[model samples]
Every structure is written in structure tokens, then in C-alpha cells.
Target: MISDLFAKIRRAFGDYAVDKRLLQEAEISKLPGFVAEYLMTEFSMNYPSDWLERLRDFVKRHYFEASEKEYVKHMLVERRKIAIIDELRIWVDLEAGEHRGIIPTIGEVDVRVPADLARKYQMAMITGMWGLIELEYSPDTAKRGPNGELLENPVVVVGFKPFQAPTSDPEILRDARQYFTLDEWLDVLLNTVGYNHSAYQTVEKKLAVLSRLLPIVEENTHLAEFGPKATGKTFIFRNVSRYTRIIVGGMISPAALFYNLRTGIPGEVAVRDAVVFDEISKVRFPNPDEIVAKLKDFMESGQYERGKQRVTSGCSIVMLGNVEVEEREGAYVPVEDFTYILPKPMRDSALIDRIHGVIPGWVLPKIRQARYHLSQGFGIALDYFSEAMHTMRKESLVGEMSKHIEVAGNITIRDERAIKKMMSAFIKILFPNLYFDNRELEIVAEFVVEMRQRVRDWLHKLSPGEFPKDTISVTVRS
Candidate 1:
């Protein structure tokens, strides 16, 4: 079998170390087979030695673990290298001595703004960084034609206010330098649109949320979140980081993220830092397969194909929504059994398999007036962290636990090494150098299974009535 040979090539060639030009050759003479040989000996992942398996194995393997293997797969795709440090050099101009707090960089509004959207934004802003306002634009915004053609115009904005301190006392702004930590400031920006809570207290509790969102945000692209309302789903898109740029829902067009715009510029979605589709269940898919089918390719292969153009838009996506069942106990269906709540497009079993994670939104407490806080001592530089993490992910240097685990039979973790690797790496991301108890590892591991099961259960439900309440459809026997 070519598995041994393939692994051999990878280990020797540094697992696809050469440039793309050298990777493609008419003859098999040009490659190193170390890693190829390694693969053959372990999992049966195979490839032609002449061509770079990273590009050719799109069909051979698909699923990736969020642990170590996920990180490995990301390296194979290899994002375009950027001089992140050199870019930071410009910011040095703003620093004086040991570095005080940084200012939020605001994107200037366009000369002509849509009034409906502007109104909603202003109203949302009144909540002072804790309310979420989502606007859907008319399709005409995405039009390209011979000048004047009528297009659909339907713009709607939804505002969800988060619990925030009532007074605009704005005391925190007097001297931002005195009372904030870098991380706290960052949370302020990200959670700015959500309901108000004590920035100091809630941010500490929500630190895990930031760690979880960081990697996904780094890999931003087309993503949709749908479910029961009030999860504060739109908060991150508006104020979190510069990497994420959002447009309202109603105004979306296929071409907005794919084809050329009215100005002949490729639409924002085409090169979206990241696109978030909130209230996703409400969005009707004209061609359901447009994103769904393309997503399967992007997730599996890291390449998106539309027309003659082949673009590598490396993005990790997040979808958030409430589970439908009411909290009441007397109902025939436990909120958990109510499958009708899942987004219709997500009803496809195959599509469900492609998703990496679907975090449960039910766990977060609802915003309450009593929970609001007036001021905070510290915060983070969101733009800096967003950009920095994006750079670090490109290094393929982050420690991951899945590396040691084996994925031999039926694609579950058969390798004890892989399991350990995942736990260690996961904890590293969260705890870093700090000490954690076994209980922590156990909880994290369970979370992983829970995420995987969510996808599996949804897939099982797609085939029709009466799926087993608890059994998830996965090939892994373990």
C-alpha cells in the first residue's frame, strides 16, 4: 500500500515542505515520501507521490478533529504568509513608553448611508455596548447591470438590548488608562453590542468564550447561526474585532460574497474577513446548495470553486442559536427532542457532518437588569489580538492533543496518544501555564463529545421519524 510510502515522503519532505511550483510534476521523481510513508503505516490516507497530496487528497480524507488533526489539516492548506510583525511596526508609532490603553479604530461611514440601517445602529448604540442590532439590506445593494435595473429592496433591522448599566455616566472614559486590563478592554469591544453586565466580572467568567471564539474568528468566512432567539448572537460581529465585517441579512445576494459588485470590485463576502449570518433560520436559501455544497468543499478541501475562479478563502465559522423547547416540564417533547427547531438547511445529514462545532446556546444566562455594571477597570485591544492570533495559527506551532491519537478504524480516536494530545493542547489554550485538575480535563473531554454528538444526532434525525433519543450516528465504535 502507498500508505507507508506516503508517510515516508511526508517525514522526509517535512510533510509538504516545498513550494507549490516544485510540488507539481509530470513524474513521481520530485517528491519526498517520508510523511507519505508515515500515513500509510497509520491511517490508510494515500496519494500520488508525484503531486502534493495536500492538493490531491481532497477525496481521500474529509473529516478533521478539532484537536490536533484539525491543526494538522490547517497546516496542509497553508495560508498565504504575511509579515505580521512588520505590520505591527506601524502601531509602534502610537506607543509612548510602557504602553497605555489603545484607542478603538473606527471605520468612517460612507457618504451615502442607508437610513433604515443607520437608525437601527443609533438605537442599538444607546444601549452603550451591550445591545445587538442586526439589519437586513435590500438585494439591490448587491446588483450589477447595465446601469438601471429594478431589484428587490427589503431592509429590516432587529434590535436585542442586553442588560447594561442605565446611566451613560460614561465615567470609564475619563481616563481609560487607570482602570482596565488588556483582556477586559477586548471583551468590551466584543460584547459591546450585548446586554450590559459588569465588564470586570462577566469578562472573567467569559474568558473561556474568548479562547473558544479566537481560533474560529481567525478562520472567518461564511457562517450562519439559527435557533431560538435571545442568545446575544450578533454581539461579536459588530464590535468584537476588525477581522469580522458584517452586513445585514435581508440584503444578502449570492454575488455579494462571490462575484463582482456594482463598482466592479469583488463583493465584500467574496473576500470577507468573516461573514456571520445571524437569525439564519429566517434566511431563505434561493439555491440551498450555494453555501452548503461549497461549504462541504471548503471544509474538506480548503478551496472554494465558483466559475473559472478558484479562491482559497480560509475561514473558520461559528453558528449560534437557542434550542426550541420551552423550559416548561409538562410538554410531550422535552425541549431536547424537538427537532423542528433546527434550521431547515441544516437538516441534511451530510451537511451536518461537515460542521466542526455547534456550541449550545442554552447554557448562557439571559441578560437581566440587575446584572448590569456601570464601569470597569480593564479591557483588551481586540484588533491586535484578532490579527495576532491569525498570524499564530498560520505557524502550525500551537500544541494540540489529537496529534497522538490514532484514527484507524471507523474514524474515531483509537489512539490513546491522540486523546492525550487533545486534552493537553486544549488545556494549554485555556489554562496556559496554570495548573488544572483532572476534573477540568474530564469536563473538556465531555464537551468535545457533546459537540460531536450534536452534529450526529441532527444527522440521524434527517432520515425521518423516531431516531433513538440518545444514540448518535457515528462510525466510531469507541
Candidate 2:
């Protein structure tokens, strides 16, 4: 059955189909799944039988570990010029009147970038880009200080080739939806993110896993997921999309999340499609009251201001944390109230209300058994898949949603919005062609309402006065 399914996926996606095992076999596990898949697809097409050898060779030659930074630099000095694949971020040094490239692995930040290269890949200046970069070492032209001492690194980025698809059409994904059953499509999505669909036996469990992707596919959809450790809550967010940023437990400042007042630069939220707060329990907000206030404003309107600089971003927010769970009738469930899952700073009712939904993370199985859980079948290349979803975010289905569904219960405006946004996301994920029948719409509506209900329940628990006991329901228009 799995082979047949793989064959079906290959037929449907054609060049986009990728065997996830190749990523591991080629020893590119250090790279992001999307980047590894892109290399696999590119190499296999150009070098069929020997693609594995070519890929392994490329990684060995071009990619370097942090420990090998000195070796790479020495090579550049000896060779004058050398090419490497790395994450390159560019920032303007107005005082110096030039753009500087930051190669994190090599720990070089003052490497000069050509003005033309900076403008050509503007995203590198914003959120950073992973690509093949040619660095030229010329100590003869190194910058000198007022005291006649060297002031900057002699290395400069002379050429770059971004490791990304030149163009992507979400219409291809949308149009291809007609070829698979909804269940098959759900499995396809799971496999694309490096999971075996068979491991999740129930449709509800599958949807629970896919909910991690809501923020990536839909704009400004704030979500939270809490469960026991190793449940794979953060895996998809960290690897599936280059547009997603994950901040592990640490002190978070307004400057890091919003606009940096000192540097006149927009933060992660301004450039990425999604910014995820992982290990939410340990996440700290310095001056909690102030940063949380800014977060509330941004979460509510997608607009923020700092130091007289105002910005608006369509980036979605996601929060993930570990919670205590116990076995209940052969299934794992949370031991404490969901309201206490967040840190004290973010425990306000106003902020909680802004979150669209809370994923029931306990339902997702732990990824302890890799051989059985990891995908071994064909799935779409992550780069192509991520780009497709990024493109799909621009196409809103709320108008189409209202034509077929209605929120018909005691609910606030926020509740209504959350339901519509989540339902629209589900439709975009499952039935992107927008051709689901009434029965199909009802199934999706039921799941969406349940998700929003989790938030409403949390709100009720947090503040009984503001949120009374209420049930959110949806009616499929006949």
C-alpha cells in the first residue's frame, strides 16, 4: 500500500517528489530538510545514478563545521578565493558606508558584501539566506583605521547563488489536490514534513500533527501547543520553512522581536512568515509588562511601534511548551490546566484571548521509534512545499468560507475570526482547490470549532468573569 501511495505521489508531484531517506543516506543531516531535499532533487535530475556520491562530495567540499572555521579561512587566504555553502546575513554599516556579511559558522561578521549583491538578494539583508557564497581574501585592500591599523576583515563576498527555487506556483499544489483523497493528502503532508502517516492511526491524531503548520500556511494566526517532551511539537516549525524562526528558551527583548530601537532595524517578526516561541515555559521577557503589552498590540492588529518607528507584518506567532501528562484510559492527557502552561508574564487574559487556538499536543505520539515513525516514502520537496505555502498565504479563503459556513452560537468577534481563519487554513491545506462538498466542509468545520473551543475553554479558566461557560459551534450552510 505504501509503495502504491509513493507511486501516486510521484505521479502527482513529478519533479517535486523526493525520497526522504536520500537526505540521510547522503549524510546531509546537518542541513535543513528543505535544503537537503533541494540538493537531492537538483542533483538526482542532473546526475541520476551517482547523485548520492556527488551530493556527499559537494557537502564535504563546500559545507564546513564551526570547528573547521580556521581551516576554511586558511584555505581562502592560501587560495585567494573559495566557495562555501552557508547561512549569509547582511547588515548595513552606515558609519563605514558599506554592507557587511555575517557568516555564522565561520564567525566572521565584518566581511564586505558588494552593493549589487546585497540589493539583488534583499532577503539576506532582512531574514538571512542560505546559499553558495564565493569569498575573496585580499589583505592588500583591507580597511585601515585612523591610527593606520587594520579595521576590518580582508574577506569579501564576491559571488552568491541562493539555494532556493527560482520560482514556485502554489497553483500547482492547489490544482494537484484533485488527484488524492483527503486522507491521502493529509498523509502526503505528514510525509513532506518527514513523518510516516501510518504511525498516526487516527484522522484526529493526524490533524493534531498538521495543526503545527497552521501558522505557516495562514497569515497572523497565533497558536500554542503544549505536551510532554519529545512529542515532535517543534520539529516541523524548525525545519519545514525557511520563513519560520524559532527562539528557544532565553531572554527575549522588544528589540529582538519587534524593532530594535538602537539599530533602526525591524526584528524577526517583520521579515519571517512565522516566529515561534519554543520552550515557552522558560522564555523570558525583560520588562515583562512592556514587552507583553507590545506583543498584545501586535498579536491583535499585526502592527507595532517602538521608538517612533511603526511597522506592520503578516508574520504569525506560535508558542510551544512541555506539559506534565498522565495516562488516562490508555491515552496521555495534560495533568494541569492549560491556562498555567504559559509563563507569568504572558498569562494575561487579554493576551490569551488574542491567540487563535491551542493545539492538544498530548494527542501527538512521541517520535521515539524513528524507523517506524520517520517517513521513508516519497513526499514533495520541502523547499517547493514551503514556497508554495508562503505563496498561498496571499490567497484568502475567508470570503469563500462565509459563503458556506456560519458561526451560530454565543461567541465574541474574536471567536468568529478565529473560527473563520482556522477553517480557511484547513481548507487551504486539505482542499486548496476550494471544491469540497457540504459533507467535507462540515468535517473541517467541526475540527476548526473544536480547536477554537480549546482557546475559549482556556479563556474561561483564566477569567471566569470575562469569559463565561460557552460553547462555540459551526453550521454548514445547506
Candidate 3:
């Protein structure tokens, strides 16, 4: 019956059956279809036929390819060895004017793309994109760094094909309701994020889960959530879309976020659909005040300037971090006693006010064995869904929500803008076909208002001196 449900959408997965025991152990089925496919394909190829026994032995010996070598050779000079990398990321060094390709599970390799290949995939390479690259790799010390340190061995790319997003038929989106019921489509959307419909038993819970997806479907949005660990706050942005870029833990510079003055090229902000800063507390900056200032301006207006070049990006920014919260009398209380656990410089009211919506991660159940939704349901392919959302971002759906809803008079203009942006994003995600009636529209509007209100409530509590005492309220006009 489960097979029957998804039979129409299932891909022709190759003959190699995934090890049943391994699948359960790795919890691969809990992942999105694409991610599961990738793992299954890779595991079958790399592990032995008796992988059950071999995997146990491999784990006993602590043989992880990643940790064995500091900088492992994922891409090799030999023809047979080079075939392993299905997708590679080519990094362009702006200062050196050199190119390098990174093979996942391994470190960086010096890249030399032929002029013709470079010219052909110029846009992709310039944006530091992922692609299947045919490279001639060698271990010889090709060049040294500015500090005279030996750089990794270089690889010459002989050929390549950049990954392209699948185009959606307008008719398909227009008539989506005819093909699938509303619940089925919502489940599919949930599946894209590795969630099982069964896990969320209520509509509010489902919408809360869906709120995390708003950034993916909306442009120039600012969203943040701080709460318990292991809630999959950063999972969708990392896995579901290639259009998104996730910075795990590191120091971020203005040049990296916006534009590099020396390179005269726009940064991740200009190209990526969603840029997620995971572990917000751990992400350091050279100049915190300066970066926060620029980020606030950009998050507010969707534009930024670096050096002499003024750059604009449609990317949504999301910040995810863990905060200590405990249950007290059926209510969650912040153990840290702070509105957010972000960097000290980033905790300002001005910066907090710019955030469109804040999901209460504390309310989200911690991802455990039972919570992981390894599904048998059919869903849109991650790439296709990503493209569809990106295309949907161009449509002006803010007016749809604005016509029926009005914010409290005390709410500032920025508050109104934040609420409208959030409402527009939710509409695109939940009602893409624009088929909802007034009652449905009211429900959606209130959901959006509540999310924005959560952000404002925190800002007011955190900085009562700066923010108004009268909290923001959304009224749906009959």
C-alpha cells in the first residue's frame, strides 16, 4: 500500500538493493529521497557485498576516510580513481586569480580548467557552483601560497557539466490540485524536508514545521530560530536546495557575505537563494558592529554596498543556534535569560527588529529515533521543488494578504513590513495556486502575524527601553 502511494513518483533506483540492516542502522530512510538515494548509491558502490559484516568491522577499526587523512585525495590523477567524484565544487581564489575544485569527503585540489571549458561554464565557475568535472589530477607540488606554504596538488579539468535546476510546467502548478489533494501536496512538501505527516498530528504543528520552509520559498527574507538542539533547524537549508549555502562555523567577513572589493564580484548574498548561518553564536566576525550594521541594512532593504559597487540580492538570510530552555509549569523558560543566544553585538534591538519572523524552536520536538520521518510517500524532487520555489519568489503575493489584514496602529513601519513579508512567504508555500477562500486566508494571515509577533515580543522583552510597550497585533477585517 505504501509502495502504491509513491509508485508514480519513485525513480528507477538501480539494481543494487540497499542493505536493509545498514539502512536501519544509518537511518537513511529518515532523510529526503534525494539524500537517501545518494547515500544508498554511494554505500553500495564503496562497501563490500558482505557490507553488514564489513561495515561492523570497519566501524570497530574506526576507519573513516574523512579522519584518516588530514587532506585526503578524493580526486586522483589516475583515470579509474578520478571517477569517484560525482559532483565537485570549484572554488575561485579572487586574490590569486586561481581556481580549485573540492571533492566532498576530501579536501581541496588545485584546479586548472581549459580556457574553452572556463568560457563555456563561466557563470557557474564565477559563482563557485557544483558540477560533474572530468579532471586530470597529479600529486606534484604545483604552487605555493603567499606565505610560502605548499598548496595541495592541482587537477586540470578536461570537461564538465554544471547542474541545472529542473523547469516546472506552468500548467502543472496551475492544476496541481487536480493531481493531488491539499493534504497530499502538504505531505509532499513536508517530505521534501524529511518530515513524516504522521509526526505532526495538528494543523498548527504542521504550519510551524512549514514556517521553517518559508525562507526557501521567499526572497529577501530574514528569519531566525533559537531553541533546543537537534530540532533539524538547519537541515532543510543544508540538504533540500543547491540554491542555498550554509556556513557551519567560522568567521564571516563583509566581503564574503556581500561583495569582495578586490575581486569586483558579488558574494553569497548576491547569488544564493537562502544563506543559513548555522550555530549563530559560533560564527565570529572581524568587525562585529560593522557586519551587524550592514546585515541590518541589507535585511531591511534587500540591498547592500561594498567598496564602490552597490550590490542587491534576493537571498533570504536565516540564523540557527541552540539555546538552553527548560519546562516550568507547562511553559518554556529560557535558562540563559536572554531573548536570543546570538553574538553580543548582534543582540541589539535594531538588528532584532529587522528579523521578519522567529520560530519558537523550543516548541519543536527534539529529533529522536521516533521523530525521524523515513517516509514511503511521494514528493517532488529536491531540485525541482527548489526551482519551483525560486520561480514562485518572483510573484508578488504580499498584496493577497495585505488586502484583508491590518496591523495594530502601535506597530512600527518596519513591523508592518516584516509581517507582510512573512505573510507573502507563507502564501507562496501553503497556497501556491492561490485557491484559498477568505476563511483560509484569515487563518494564514493570523499564522504569519503570530510568527512576527513572536519576534517582536522577544525584542520588547529584551529591550523594553528601546521597543514600545504596546505589542503588535494583527486584525483581520471582515
Measured over all alpha carbons after superposition, the RMSD of each candidate to the real structure, in angstroms, is 23.6, 2.0, 5.7
* lDDT at residue 472 of model 1 (Cα atoms): 26
- Candidate with better lDDT, 2 vs 3: 2
Please report how far candidate 1 places residue 257 from its true position, in Å: 2.2
Greater-TM-score candidate between 1 and 3: 3
Q: Pick the candidate with the highest lDDT.
A: 2
Candidate 2 TM-score, true structure as reference: 0.95
lDDT of each: 0.36, 0.86, 0.65
lDDT of 2 by residue, 1-478 (tens): 5588899999998888888866556468778888888887788889988988999999888988889999998899899999998888888888778899989767987799989999999989977888889999987788788887878888889999888875568777877788998889999999999998999988889889998888988999999898989989888987788889999989998888888777666788988899999998889888898889888999999998888988999899999889899999999888888767688989899998999988888988889876778898898889988888888898778788888999978999999898898887888888878778888788778888988898898888888888998998889998
Q: How accurate is candidate 1 locally (lDDT)?
A: 0.36
Higher-scoring candidate on lDDT, 1 or 3? 3
Looking at model 1, which ten-residue stretch has the lowest summed lDDT? 82-91
Question: In candidate 2, which residue ranges exceed 4 Å CA deviation?
Answer: 65-80
Query: Rank by TM-score, descending?
Result: 2, 3, 1
Model 1's C-alpha root-mean-square deviation from the true structure amounts to: 23.6
Error of 2 at 345 (Å): 1.0
Predicted structure with the largest TM-score when compared to the true one: 2
Residue range 291-318, candidate 1, lDDT tens digits? 6777567655557766666767655544
Is candidate 1 or 2 superior in TM-score? 2
